[model samples]
Target: MSTTSQLAKRFREVLLDGLWIANTNFKDQLSNVNMEQATAKIGSLNSIAMLTFHIDYYIAGLSNVFEGGKLEIRDQYSFDLPPLESEEQWENLKSKLWKDAEKFAALLEQMPDSKMNEGFVDEKYGTYLRNIDGMIEHCYYHLGQITLIKKLLKQKESV
Candidate 1:
């Protein structure tokens, strides 16, 4: 395969790791999570609902970039998920998450290697490769937090 194709494949792999495969994928971590569990908190940390929204927020924002849209996300409002008060709401969010993940992965797979090496927005924001890789890392980091919080919530219920 050509170098661009190879880079695109690698990018897809990283996106898959973030969304589905890497042992600690978001899908697996979120399995069996009820709306109540998702909104539960462990101490001062964010709830699973908030964390999930936070993850999707950036993915959606970056996905916009790849779609030729302007970057309109603000970090300060990243965690502002609508209240996940009903099972229907949680399920809707999950549906949106899966759709966004798949669309984001497809966008990455279609990216040219040259574009990946170019600045994502401005020189200060860094290359698309760096931003994509950082997104993978960010997902894993928050997945850990999600798992731990879920465990703590279970423990609290048991006690």
Candidate 2:
């Protein structure tokens, strides 16, 4: 497979359906979590919903760039999830994440391998490959946190 195709596959593995790395994807983990559980606090760590929004924030931002738009995502507002007071809101967040993830993967797959060596946005951010790889790594890092948080919430419930 081409590099971009491989990268897209890896990206999907974390957010959508592949079970090679963590044995769990965001869709699987977030599917069963209700609004209360998603927004529940587990000590100093971010809630599941917050993490979901955080990742989606970046995914959507980068996707814009891939679609010929500017890179407009700022780190300060990445975690700025709107009030998820109801089940409908929580579902919306997950739905957006899934949709954005799919879009991001599709964009990546369509990219030419030659573009991978070019700088992403500007020279300071590194190559396109670097940024894409970083995103996959970032997702896995947060995915682990989400998994642990779910376990902790489950443990708390049984207590």
Candidate 3:
């Protein structure tokens, strides 16, 4: 296969790894979490709802860059999620995450292999490929946090 095909396949693999694949993915980690559970705070760490929004915040920003838009994100505001007051609100956040993940994967599939090595936005941010890979790593890092928080919440409930 051509390099472009290989790159596309790699991109899909990373995306799938983040979204599915049993124990590694958010689909199972976020499973059956109600609004209250999501918003539950354990100690000083961020709530699951906040972490979910934070993950999607980065995805949405990078996705804008891939779509030829500017990256309009700020670190200070990434975790500023509104209250997940109801199941409907939590569902909406989850829906947005799934849709954005799909859109991001589609964008990757359409990317030209030649452009992967090009600088993303500016040289300071590194190459497009690096940024994309970073997104996957970032998700997993936060996914671990989310999973731990969920487990802690469950333990608290059981006690």
Candidate 4:
């Protein structure tokens, strides 16, 4: 497979399905989470919902760039998750994440392998391959956090 295709596959593995790396994808982990559990606090760490919004924020922003939009996402606003007071709101957030993830993967798959060496957005941002790889790594990092938070939440429930 081409590099772009491989990258897309890896992206899907983390956000959608496939279990080669963490043994659990975002879909799997979030499927079991309700609004209460998602928003529950585990010490001072970010809630699962906050982490989900943060990851989706970057994915959607980059996907916009892939679709010829301007790079407008900022780190400061990435965690600005709106109040998820209801189950519907929580579901909507997850729905957006899944939709954005699929779109991001599709766009990545369609990208020319030659463009992988081209700088992403600007020369200072480094190459498309680097950004794509960085996103995958970032997802894994937060995925680990979400998994641990879920465990802690479950433990709290049991007690």
Candidate 5:
């Protein structure tokens, strides 16, 4: 593979690793909990459900940009993905996020060199590279939140 291709592949791998951590640590648990339960605070943050949404949402958003599209966000968006209307809704998005992530990763992996450096630009960030960088960082950032959420969930379960 070419250097650019290699870079994109590695980037996909990083995001995939994030996907595994997110899905295993949180999304899989959504089936067992209600919306309120999923959004329930362990302490400081909202809950695993919301964090999961934020993670998946941004991955999809950035992936779309890499795929030659863009989505509008308010003030750089936030890390917290809110709860759905009900447990059922949350369960649905839970599944959709996984599928969306897989598709996102695949599209990003195909990104060509010419396009990787190109994307909707903002004065603050400038270039798709920086935004993509932010997207990657965002994943790991929430993985930290997910780790804490998982620990809390385990504690709750054991008690």
Candidate 6:
């Protein structure tokens, strides 16, 4: 394979890995907690469900762009949940996330390395790679947040 194809393959792999890490990290934290506990905020940041939603928020934006849509943000969906209030709501939000992740992975698969430098600018992130690699890097950074929160939750649970 050409170097470009190799890069794209690695990028897609990382992108998929980020989604898995985010999902697993969050689930690990919320595992022991019941609906009542999961609903509680982890401080001023957001609840576990909200953080998970935020991770989905990023992936969803990438999906919109890959599909030739524009985005101010993904949570603009009429029923977006910033903070799910119940177990049923969290599970539903998670289900939507799974669908988004699957579609996003397919987008990654179709991407051509030639498009990596295509160039995109947003008021928020500014000019960027216009490639899956950059998006994967961004996703993993947020997944790290999930890991941190999960660690704290585990510590608390044991105490």
RMSD of each: 2.7, 0.6, 2.5, 0.6, 4.0, 4.6
Please report, in order, the local distance difference test score of every candidate based on alpha carbons.
0.79, 0.96, 0.78, 0.96, 0.62, 0.59
Compose the digit string of candidate 6's lDDT tens values, residues 1-159. 744455444544443432343444333444455555545556775555665676677778877887888865744562255655677876776667667766776675666655555665454554334445566565566557656766677777799
Tens digit of per-residue lDDT, candidate 1, span 18-86: 444455567777768999999887779999989889989998999999999998999998998978779
Please write out the lDDT profile of model 4 over residues 89-133, one tens digit for every residue: 999999999999999999999999999999899999999999999
Estimate the TM-score for candidate 6: 0.67
Q: How well does each candidate superpose onto the true structure, as a TM-score? A: 0.88, 0.98, 0.88, 0.98, 0.69, 0.67
In candidate 6, where is summed lDDT lowest over 10 consecutive residues?
A: 12-21
lDDT for predicted candidate 3 compared with the true structure? 0.78
Clashes of 6: 0
Angstrom error of the Cα, residue 139, model 5: value is: 0.5
TM-score of 4: 0.98
lDDT per residue as tens, model 3, 5-111: 55444544443443443255665666688999998889999988898899889888988988999989989999989877789999899878877877887787778
Model 5 lDDT-worst window of ten? 18-27
Error of 4 at 140 (Å): 0.4
RMSD of 1: 2.7
Residue-by-residue lDDT tens digits, candidate 2, 1-159 = 999999999999999998999998999989899999999999999999999999999999999999999999999999998878899999999999999999999999999999999999998999999999999999999999999999999999999
Off by over 4 Å in 6: 1-34, 74-80, 121-131
